[model samples]
Target: MTVESPAAAHARGAAVIGPIHAPKASEIFADLLRQKILDGEFPEGQPLPSERSLGEQSRLSRAAVREAIGILKQQGLIVSKPGRNGGSIVTRPTSQELVASLQTYVRSQGWGADNRTLLEMREIIEPWCAAFAASHRTDEDLQRIRQRLDQASASIDRVEEYVSAGLSWHAAVADAGHNVLLSAFMSAASTPFLSAADHGRYDSLKARKSTLKTHKAITAAISDRDPQRAFDLMARHVQGSEAPLLENLATTLENDTAATG
Candidate 1:
């Protein structure tokens, strides 16, 4: 029996997988530009070449160049300017952009409706964030955390206001942790919880008071630079909050199903 050549074997496998489509010129150009920007070849705040210039250098049409530029703009890698001497400017992506993109993706995936998942995420992240803040926090950070805690305490009786302040207090802790990615993720993950609160899914004097009490304790731990205490307090706080949050979510989901049924 004749042995199959490597080329023939590869061709057979390719046939099973079907043909690969070539990327669009715009996509290829956008990828190249993105790499250059990220690699610091094109420094932030520097103007990219004119569309006509880019078209000439890349051997792409003007429309393709424009499309590539638009792609970069959408990805938060660049900003476009109008008028004379105006073109795309290179820029680094910010946490706010990450927050927006993450929020969009989470919403699109129909996440955040399940309280259990959110609680799980919080349990993993917030405790560490609190612990980190204990070591990394500045006086300014402590001040901000204290202010947010006060706001949360004052607003405890009002569901919407309390939720807003409560979220802010959480955000302050994340920020004080000095971890940019975690802070952005926390900000994005908060949207659904805020929505739940807006609907008045769970509101009670007891729960609010409990939250404030735990928040104050966590804040004190961080302020005192006690990472272990901060971690423990935050973990306990998240764990304690879970039952009420989940119960309310379940009730809301049932009522929605009943109404829609």
Candidate 2:
């Protein structure tokens, strides 16, 4: 029988005693790099170590290091340049990208309560966004908002059209805020609520008329560049609209429970 070297014996021991299901080397390296970036160990615009160096440091192959860098690039945490200074550089994460990823993740989780919570959170944030938009809106932005409002008003008889227009109007307000992050976040969060609002039993002519009036008032406040008025009107509009829907949902849920019981 041949005696194995100490290093070989240690390797055999590690194979038995180490993690039963360790992550792939590339994934492990990617996670380590991602944590380093988040921890500010790698500042924005700073180039990452060369693949060879990273491989040496991590005891991984060059291919594993490259794969890890590719993963980081996809996450918007780094970018690659192709030149003498060409390497992966740390980058600031864009809010749009972050929100998009988050939206996808939430949808994948198949959670209904998350959508409701998102709507509640938007109710808290979007009024401020509307107020900012009103304060800072240019003539062009106001004109665009007016066009959407007019379209919505004209389509009040058609539920689908009306719902589409309503969403557009809210989106216009968010766009007028001139903050991409705020706009993206509001747009994503409001999607399910907007769908729920559309399908609820609020499509009556009377409800349409009331909604139009409230929308008009809010638009007028925005057009007038009255931040306070716009904020107040938007807050009232959301609360007023949400109350009836919440009551209807609660009643429906109670009835369902009673019937089952």
Candidate 3:
């Protein structure tokens, strides 16, 4: 009537268990270093030990130590400096790096070719971001948004400049929302949106003017601290803008299918 322990039952071939795989030495070492960096034990701008020293301390070979460092470097946890005074230094990832990583991830997921999906994501996040900006934005945030808005207005006839300014304005709004992740995501999404717009249909003067009008209205709503107005304006603005882009994408896809077939 006695029940056997799981470990003992497994050992006696009476229990089935998944295979146990040990992590590589490099991964273990990398995890240790990553934890230290994140925990502030290894503060930013401080150089890590030399490869030989790290190898000695970790009881790993030079290759294994290098592999660990490489993993950390790739993860944006540390930077490698060359020269006599140079080595790996603990560092946090920059905003630009985060955007780059997010862009890579988006592309990997096949989201680049289909901008409707990206627009759908923006539709979900941006209205709330505008609402938050309406409630939370500071004078400096207002000024930044105005600056980009003015730039967009001035560059309405210039496709590249207009798109760039428009994206910057959206990013400013996201930043004003006081949400770091949303701001980063807005920045990351900009490049792909730009790529899609570069095909020329989105740069029509009429469309630019309409977009500018909506942006100005959205700005006004945020300036007046009207979250509902800001939210509605942004929602409509995004939906209005998404239509032409989606239509263009559909046309392009159909043309491609016809050509391929």
Q: Pick the candidate with the highest lDDT.
A: 3
Best TM-score among the predictions, by candidate number: 1
List candidate 2 segments past 4 Å from native. Answer: 1-28, 35-49, 80-90, 109-115, 194-198, 241-261
Better of 1 and 2 by lDDT: 1
Between the candidate structures 1 and 3, which one is better when assessed by lDDT? 3
Candidate 3: which pairs clash?
Answer: none
Question: Ranking under lDDT, best-scoring first?
Answer: 3, 1, 2
TM-scores, each model vs. reference: 0.81, 0.69, 0.73
Across residues 108-138, which tens digit of lDDT does each residue of candidate 3 receive?
7766524767877787889999999999999
**What TM-score does structure 1 among the candidates reach?**
0.81
Which ten residues in a row are the worst by lDDT in model 2? 110-119
In candidate 1, stretches whose alpha carbon ends up further than 4 angstroms from where it belongs are: 1-19, 113-116, 198-202, 241-261
Clashing pairs in 1: none
Each candidate: RMSD: 8.8, 8.4, 9.5
Cα lDDT over the full model 3: 0.87
lDDT value, residue 9 of candidate 3: 84
